[model samples]
Target: MLVKHFPGETIGIIGSSMASALLAQEAGRLGYRVASLVLQEQNPVRQFCNWQTICPVYDETALRHFAGRVDVVVAETGLLSHQDYKILAAITDLTLSDDLMAITTDRLIEKVFLDSQRCLVTPFSMVTSLKDIKEAVEYIGFPCVLKTTQRHLPQSSDHVILYSEEDYERAERKVEESTCILEAWIPTEKKASLTLVRNERGEMLLYPVFEVIGSGELHLKQVRYPANISSMVEAEMRRVAQVIGQALDLIGSLTLEFFITSAGVVYINEASVGLSSEAIFTLGSMSMSHFEATCRALVGLPLPDLLPRGRAAIALPLVDLNYDEVMTQYMMRTDWHFAFFNPRGHSVEDMQGYVIVIGDSIKHCERQIELSRLTHHPK
Candidate 1:
């Protein structure tokens, strides 16, 4: 069944991707119908108010049903079957590419572009067999890292850092599971990402490059705006992003990750094709949301005119189970939204939970968060 007023006008989301929920929020706010696909395990009845869930057993059938119902169909996380994308093309517009491009998935494609273009990239080689692995190590050097060529699946991101022959052999069992890309591990002096968006008319919007500081565990610790890098490096990052976007013939938001070495060298890290509202939200605060931009783009609308007003914002994820108990006792001073203790409902991975708090000063933000840690209190 379809809504009567906006007959044949609904936005379709293929998975429970973060972008799906965020964009659904915006679309729902604008009185547009949002129909989402829910797997068997998900709660189909309790989707966000702005959206409805449609379940289909087959990929092509699902695509056909959704195409008939929605004006725009967006696949989040690149999780949909390729055949689904082909089917989606028959009925409605399928916009937005998976964000994790160049740096992760499709490394060969990335290499092809890098080879022809002057844009700088991390040195990498693909490993198809055991012999190829040895050759790759010899060519790319030791202490090099092994990752998959296709970044489509979750397991593809699992990697091993080879320090020795034994380490290479130890990693061989796992490396043989997928197509690997071996790259020299550059010691990162800093990490930053640029959120780039382009409309159907090709007007590009570049958000303030945000710095990501972490412990190398792949867990994001912090995000800061107006990236604190040398002007030369900053300019280079933007130039590279612009070049890549043009090369991809990109139409929506693109997220690019980078590494700035201690030697003032910059290396491309990773990229995602669609608008990452979570990352952009951390940098821009409430004034602008990538969710809104994505909704407009999917509907063939222009991007919301937004500018970085120089307001500093920070986002920290709270992964402890006893988050609320700790916050009640110590975090009495600062403002924060405990995602795990949501009044509406609980979300996935509450144990690996998250909370968002904003502060006028970075020092204030850090202090408040540090004081609120679950490990420091009297047990």
Candidate 2:
């Protein structure tokens, strides 16, 4: 059963990442008291939250006590174990359900669930041993990616791309160490995602689709709102997202990432519950940001009317830049919005901060991104 929270009620947040901080800020704006459970006393989220509890999520007694003090709990890290889920469910309402977590946490299970819904997905095969690697390669062909099936694996590089037989031999060794899944690498023309919020009543609200532009290494480079896609394609993507959300009985926000091939075929890449990193780009573009929508859904509030401001692009730095330096340089440009997560020692690869540029047109946004890239990361 779903739980409801009213204004003035406390919202407990799990994890201490930028998403948690953003959620706390939005919840506070809506008159909801926010408390965060953090693993460290120096967590950045602590500054935005009303109360901070320093305790590991797996510590049942501590988690139960934390839950008792809040009306609902939202997890941002997506690192909760089954035991952790059990403890949270027993004490407080979770933004994501345990059953949904079980399915989405594992890449294989998530793919299977999408397939069961008759949703188109990338060609994939599950590999449990070295022998399965050859079979997977034979079916998926070369230039495929082998990803670990381990739920919540903390390793930064969980997937390896294989382009040749020699690469396959190396991938086979890597796969043998753990269960893996082989997926054919689609020559994607564009990568887009639809972020939606769903309530227990089956009501749904859709945000404008955004194109995910990535660097050569697959790190997010920029996100462009109102994806460069046709109306028909956008409608189909929204329909698929709605179907998946309704199928899971999603209680809060859900994001469905899709790969659009050159032929215009859309294939499901993955789905995530709660907040996603790319959603930050929606801050100034949408009437209701993803964080606000998630908070509203969690507290049983009606969805707000989503209206777009203008063409917007979110640029993520590929190299670390001094926050003050970047801000000082762009301070005169009112069209640019800056947000630094304050992950002090983290590299650009960690997605620490982003710049949002709103323009009169998409071409203008692209020009801004190119100019900023050249200025910040010159060749």
Candidate 3:
């Protein structure tokens, strides 16, 4: 059963990332009291929350106390499992759709579910041993990616890309060899994602699709809004996303990532729940912040149509590696929008900030990105 709450009621949030902070901020802006369970010693989310419980998520005494005070809970799923959400629902109202969250959070299960729906996911084989990897390589071929089936893995432990058979011997030292998935690496021309919110009543609203322009060597160079894609491709992407939404009977925000092959076939890459860091990519381009749209759904309000606000927008992710370069450009160009995190993490790969620029054309936006010292490889 689904739960509903009024605008003035308290909404509890889990996790301490920027995504969680933005959700809390939007909830507060809409007159809802925010409460959260904090994981980090310092996080921007605490300032937004009316009340906060600073403890491990599964801490019974603290979790129960947090749940007791809130009218509804909306967890950012990366750090919490479906079982944790189930426990939260038992204690109080949890807004996420259990079935959708359960499947989407696990890559292996999500791939299986997508296949079951006849969605075009990459060719993959589930493997538990090196022998399975060799067999999958025989069909999927070299340059495939080997991913652990583990949920909530650290950024560094997530996946290993193999270019040859020698890499398989190297993968044993890197990846968690328990249960994994071997997927063929698609030759992509563009990578894009569409975010949508569906309510229990079956109403849905779609956000502007964005293209990720990355360096082939595993780094996100830039992101552009209203992606450079054909109208036919866009329609197909929307159809696939909505189909998954209806199949799951989802009642919250969902983001579906797609890979466009060199021949222009769009393959479903993955899905995520809640407002992820990727939302920042199209920050100034949307009619309203994604936060507001998602909040309206969370509180059982009617959904609104989200249109592109500007001609185009491009966002460059700032990490310690590129912080100096972005800051130099920031001083010279007063047009770019920046969102920085106050409580920084230990990992350098964690996004430290963003430099977003909205312009009259994608060419204009691309110029800004190029000037920021970020290379945009349109793959």
Candidate 4:
């Protein structure tokens, strides 16, 4: 069902994530009332919400009561189960699609959907045991990642890359512990991500692709707007993004991460239905941030198309370990835009703060990056 929202109408936000809080804030700013449900200990939404219900996310009674208090519902993915999706869909205007959730929440299922849509996907095959993994590796090739289908497992136990048979020992426990899928790891010089938003009428919006600069091991570094890729690669990424969005019947926004090789081969990594901390750059870089754009898309309002407003923008995430260094630079770099999270739901490692540097061109941002010593820990 197509649901259109107007000012003063209650928009029910159904998660405690920062993404949900950001959405609530935007909905409120747009003249809409924001109602929220959150867990007590972690309540980023409480400060922004007009009306709030505090409870466990899966509590049926609480969920129903919360649903009834608003006109439309939006949830940050990972907060709801397949059954919960059915429950909420039946009772209220749940904006996130159950099919999309069902597919995206499971890596194997998501890869299958992407394949069926004729979108590029990393080569993969499910492996159950040492024998299965060894045989699969022959075709999937070396330097492949072994990942558990279930994401809720411990992070360490979930993934291991197999470069050879000796490496299988590292992944043996994961393969034995859960249903696992092995995927060919595309060696790449650049990692890029695209955010896509779709309205109820099936209209969609694509934000500019972001190029993520990280370490050789893929550790965090910084993110630059409008990926420095050839026009052909960018065009193909956009083409697949539209196909995936339309196929998912998306009623909200999601991000797709892609691996771009030095040779310019583009391989889809994975899709995330939940809010991405990586995309926080949109806040300082674009004319319309992802939060506001997602709200507008959900309510059947005009989307601003998320155009880049500046010549270039880069986002640097801060952590607890960098306190002294960040502060020293903070004093010197008054021009930098620094945003600190509310210390509500976020752990220090997830993100203590972030700095966004926007300039007239990529050259200017590059200069700022050197001044900030973004490549090294604040010393």
Candidate 5:
């Protein structure tokens, strides 16, 4: 049986994003009042979100005030300051803070489960001072990732990889201002994400494993599901994800990133504490919205089994609007579909264009995306 939280209550979200907006819509659809705390009214393209219409929280003062008004607070944007989580945690009624300390401490939220028998973690140490850096290097060796401990950069990627003593020296200087995690970079053959929801009772409902295709784009990359990775690797990824979930005492929805190296080793990367819309999109394209999954999880309702409905689906972010003239090039394609669109004249800050394509095969889908890029992308 699924566990339930407050029914028909309002749920608060921090950050104005397509993910938050879609999540808010889902909550409202599920009979709960939804309010999003955001910084601006204008839609800023959330590098990590799909749908748009996020509520704006313009400033720190606004965020503090917004936190006091909602019953349940969820931070969708990874861009959080310490003040954000502190304010949300202060709201005793009910609150879900994302990987605030996980990112801030540089401890992969997955590391919270290092004690578990299921995990094989790399040698790592916390960097608190300049001296700690030397110990970390001595212990973990070179070619390690130096990252802040907080989830300060939720929507985008941050942190530096040190491959030499000189690189480590520069990264160590920044350590005094933030908690850093020092860990060996695992070179994996493939990468995947496990998005799941844990009921209040601690039972976990694992979503289908989704493959993460690396992109040169900082955070606005494409993710494909119904992965091509080994079923064994997928199973192990799920197993490790569950271990991390239980260890963190994670509530509601979460996402765990992993590296499945050519050697068949699955190294846990990071953990996301709130709803993962990117993974949700993969599921959404397949069948149901992850937004619905979150809503159902929040209310303690049994989740519907998700089956792949579409064979191949792709989402391309409209990053530059100035190239509006080029849109006609993609509009010419017969194989693509506009799953979502921005109202005419309504502009987005981070991304100005949007298109979603679903085809009969991944090859067709990839071809459409490539073709669209060739025609519309600015030279």
Candidate 6:
């Protein structure tokens, strides 16, 4: 089970998103040479890595050439097809197994894996046609969520919530043209995620659970560290995460998102084997961040002991704002941390960034968010 160490070695990243940039930054901090393979010529992540190459992921010859130059490869964007994974696995050491990557990227496969483990998951059924949608509705009940089974589909929203027949009728055409999954939408008392890292030695480390707040589109809007759930609930979540990680034989960082019902029932919502967006808050709140932990795990390094400083909140703004202006306004606030991604000539609306505020109490964190609202809007 001894994996290769990556100190002073090259780490290859596959993707050009903000998450990929963060990974490159973390790897650089750990003394690893970073190289990124991107599809576009103007990727913002180019600034964060030591080397960058423009190549399509589907081109196996280009992928092999890129993989040959790195000690290990990590896919930041979960848009890789099954064949792409196979090509990468054949060329280099992947942080995740092909099976794990295949399962975690597809919603239908993920649900089936969770069910096979006897994990508590939301009621779900696959829908490929209008007749299938009706059957799924009958099984999962009304007020459910319809989401694409595959990631990065062409010209489609990731998910939609249907409250009535009208909503379903309006979405029927789109649903019929693509594969989808229908899941009963539980009224959650709290939405939280547990991030864990499994190293090559089979050792696992679990970080503090983060209470998540999302926008109407289900994008994570805010994250609070050290979730306010009971100890028993936290322990249960840890157990479930460990089980899922072990079952997958996962060797990198994984995040399992959960929904806590009013009755205290915990249900698995989804899983991500890549870096989570909440890493910004973790870097501000915990002694070790998810990005750093992921790098450590991939290189056969031991996980660090998590030491939480205080309550931390991360605000994700929906509207585009002047980066310098936002930084200048928050520079005087020593307790606040701001990170703005380089837009690389892209529109601000397409940019992703976060502001982290650490406070002594939850109310103090809330006050910082309220104060920030004077300048930034959700839009």
What's model 6's lDDT at 185? 91
Give the Cα-based TM-score of candidate 6 against the true structure: 0.86
Runs off by more than 4 Å, candidate 3? 56-62, 154-157, 173-177, 214-221, 317-355, 366-379
**lDDT (tens digit, per residue) of candidate 4 on 79-171:** 665666677778888776767767645778888988988777899998889888889888888989998776544552347878777887778
Question: Which stretch of 10 consecutive residues in model 2 shows the poorest summed lDDT?
Answer: 316-325
Clashes per candidate (backbone, < 3 Å) = 8, 0, 2, 0, 21, 0
Please give the range of 10 consecutive residues that has the lowest summed lDDT in model 3.
Answer: 343-352
Estimate, for each residue in 244-335, the C-alpha lDDT of model 5 and write its tens digit. Answer: 66766656787777777788887767666776756534533555566677666666666666666567665555453224533564567554
1-379, model 1: which lDDT tens digit per residue? 1112242377776665444565666677766777777664343223553455546453677668767877776665445544456677667766634322332236666665665676567778877777887887776778888876665655765678888788867568766777777888888888888877766666666666787656543334556665778899988888988887776667667788888999888887776766474463442354456666666655656665666433555555454324565457435633443332221255543433245545665676657567656435446
TM-score, cand. 4 = 0.83
Q: Candidates' TM-scores?
A: 0.78, 0.85, 0.83, 0.83, 0.77, 0.86
Q: What TM value does model 5 have?
A: 0.77
Question: Residue-wise lDDT of candidate 3 within 1-379, one digit each (tens)?
Answer: 7667777899888787766787888899889999988866678687678877788545666667778888887777566655666677788877666666677457788898889999999999988777788888999998999876656555534578999988988666544445777899999988889888888888988777887677642124666787888888899999999998889887778899999987889999887767656677555566666767777788888776667767888776565236556656667765556666655344443445567778888888867666655543333
lDDT of 6 by residue, 230-285 (tens): 88889999999999989898888888899998888999998877777665677666
Off by over 4 Å in 6: 56-61, 155-157, 164-171, 214-220, 315-335, 343-352, 368-379
Per-candidate RMSD, Å: 5.1, 3.8, 4.9, 4.1, 5.1, 3.5
Error of 4 at 282 (Å): 1.5
Instruction: Give the Cα lDDT of each candidate.
Output: 0.62, 0.76, 0.75, 0.76, 0.61, 0.77
Q: After superposition, how far is residue 92 of candidate 1 from its true place, in Å?
A: 2.3
Check candidate 3 and list the clashing pairs: 189-379, 190-379
Misplaced by over 4 Å in model 5 are 1-8, 44-64, 77-92, 95-110, 115-117, 153-157, 201-204, 214-219, 246-249, 320-356, 359-361, 367-379
Error of 4 at 353 (Å): 3.7
Candidate 1: Cα lDDT at 195: 79
